[model samples]
Target: MTSQVRGGQLARLLGQWHALPGRRRSPDYAALAAAVRGLLADGRLPLGVRLPAERELAEALRISRTTVTAAYRALRESGHLTSRRGAGSWTMLPGGHRVASSGLWTPQDDLDMIDLGIAALAAPPELVPATRAATEDLPRYLGSAGYHPTGIIELREAIARSYAERGLPTSPEQIMVTNGTQHALDLVLRLALAPAGSVLVESPTYPNALAALAARRARIATHGLALDAGWDADLLLASIRQSRPRLAYLIPDFQNPTGHLMPVDLRERVVGAAHAAGTDLVVDESFVDLPLDGTPVPPPTATFDRHSRVITIGGMSKPYWGGLRIGWVRASAPQVQRLAAARIGVDMSSPVLDQLVAVHLLADAATIVAARRTQLAHQRDALLAALAERLPQWRVTVPRGGVTLWAELDGPVSSALARAAEEVGVRLAPGPRFGLDGTLERFLRLPFTLPAADLVDAVHRIAAVRYDLDRAGRPQWREPSVIA
Candidate 1:
């Protein structure tokens, strides 16, 4: 059973509930109860997760105790919640059903859900031919024991060569392939951080990376990256000096969600600061190759690491295809060896076929990058245009690269808006999902990975829900946070 949620967690969840639509026609208590039921139906509030006390939730939401009591009573009557004299209310599916935690995007059996949660692109046209070509070479590995813990030597050399061309001299010995960047990040965190060790991460960073670090019980220290200003080198330097974290993880190039790239000079300074503070840097270059603009790609962070303090993680998932599931860590040879050894307990090696396909794809990197740049640029523009025409209240920045747009909603009801959008067949990742605690309620990440027509239609659905919320006389809650 999931542990009981209380205080801030429950407050955050309830805040999302309060943002639902149809409040104009329904009683406050009934509206609140229906919001809670919607969350339960969508698996956002998992079955068996205990809720906050009625009074506590009321205070958090700044609503009356009677209102919350009535809402809880309604939920209990509907069989969506259960309460006892002492035990706080617990969420339940109707008929005592249970649902598993499916993270942020749970696919509904319904065919029309437009997924804007995952920031990834489908396989490029090159993937099919590349995989077929890889088959001819597969026979060579068939005679071997078939388990190469680090990676097959050929693929490693190709990756190293790619790095060298980008101004970072890397040996094949410096590379260790993993299932994806997430796995590579996990291995590095395990190798570098002790339990409860401090880790400096970018505020509004990739949610999955935050989840992985939390799982390791690391104490996360944050430095916010302004969408306009990008990384504040001095602030980041100060954070590293003050916190003295064991590691610092950053996505300097076309950062996830925000799409801000750290300048080359800032990159050098950050590496130097981390080195002086004795913190290793884990830089994610997953979106580095997906630049929509024609600017030359920034060199790898390792290029600035005079002390070998940077562990660079790159993957084929974002630029080429997520299904390939091929990623690598470019670190010191010793660190690479350590990570490979640590992988012994996990799956011994990535699939040979996937690695082979990745090698073929990497060989065609320039063409693949160009194709993605053109495609994403078109989709990004379409999304921006749609949002401007349909939801003028939303403020969105034009990302230089990457697949997602970090959009600021007009109010602090992203969770509520997402829930409302779901009823209209649109899936969204609310802002709070990206941040620790209950912050970022006013933000949402919108991906342009879908076709232009679907992108337009998704925006229309979201606008419809926003219209409903507006009609319900929901107070427009605004925040001062601004992103360029």
Candidate 2:
């Protein structure tokens, strides 16, 4: 018989539970087996709880029942389960896998898993043609000793024109090419941030950015954008005033994991806020082109950067492909020189070939954007529709642009849900991985960059995994798993 957890019975047992960790010859056996034991020790699963039948789990896994029996036998021998004849295997854990009811995003099989972690669509077919065209012009630049630190004028001019079309008045003198968006951002940070100086960023913001600042030991102050609706102006201004940070980083168009787009008015206020606070503003528009809506997108944050303080970091990765490795910073002429110097030790220059590909793609951006806009819209819609129909227990808000659907799962099992999805062929990133500390443990960021068919299959697999966990008494499954 099952019994509810009462008193410190759980906390006390939880403190004493122990599960040995070891690598298994079987990838599937390793993570799950260890997890089962760990969960028992942690008191996440009370004694006498029914374990999902071995046959059912094995069927879902496409594995033999013998293997499942072996796994269960091992757990039982280790004091995890009390398997009596016909009584079925029941959780009688004091020691076992450190599986928690809330870990949906742990490792499953290192093989047979398709990772949908960062939101990036495969490159468009046209990218190859652009690379060839850029290669043809490479020979001419080679005559100049290939030491152009200010970067090839062709790519710089192209990026400047892109800004101009985006409603930002820009000139070639205001652009600098870098290895990628991160590189450009790092260079800008190197130039702008002082040791212990503060930076204003969104809580649950990009962790890489946090790591970058941490590398410099810079103090970061954050404002909340949890509404998933984008930036909150009043709180943002307060952060600006209170922290008086040296730099402010924003993804205003579709802020990373939160998927919130900072409205036009908020953008204006933030720019003014930074200017008044004597702060430098840096905006990343990496996924600006990936909205599900097929239409022209907005310009970079530099549109209101009259003081030349805002540095806009952009890349061809999202629009073109992740392998492109091409990004640039739009800043004043003086700032461009500053970045060139900062990057001398990093890499004398980005590969001449890669820059060529970016140049050619920049030439045909309009057509490329149109095709990408259509494809992403379809993929995103299909994923959202599937989630709505199959996993209504979750909440997912439709993003205007950007490749992810930031959904909040009902329970605290986002991490658990991720772990379960792995066993079922769907690899996912835990919400916490995208946030600072444990800020978003209940949220899930789903990527819709795959083709419509794959997105459909992925959502379906995710649903089946969720259903199995619920049936197995892992009912901490987020209710309304698609919480918007």
Best by TM-score: 1
Candidate 2 lDDT over 292-346, as tens digits, reads 5543455566777678778889888788888988888888889888888888877
Each model's lDDT: 0.81, 0.71
**Candidate 1 lDDT tens digits, 302-402:** 89888889999988898888888899999999999999888998779999988999888988989988888899999999999999999898888788888
Clashing pairs in 1: none
Model 2, CA-based lDDT: 0.71
Best by lDDT: 1
Deviating ranges (above 4 Å) for candidate 2: 1-111, 294-299, 470-484
Stretches of candidate 1 off by over 4 Å are 6-107, 473-484
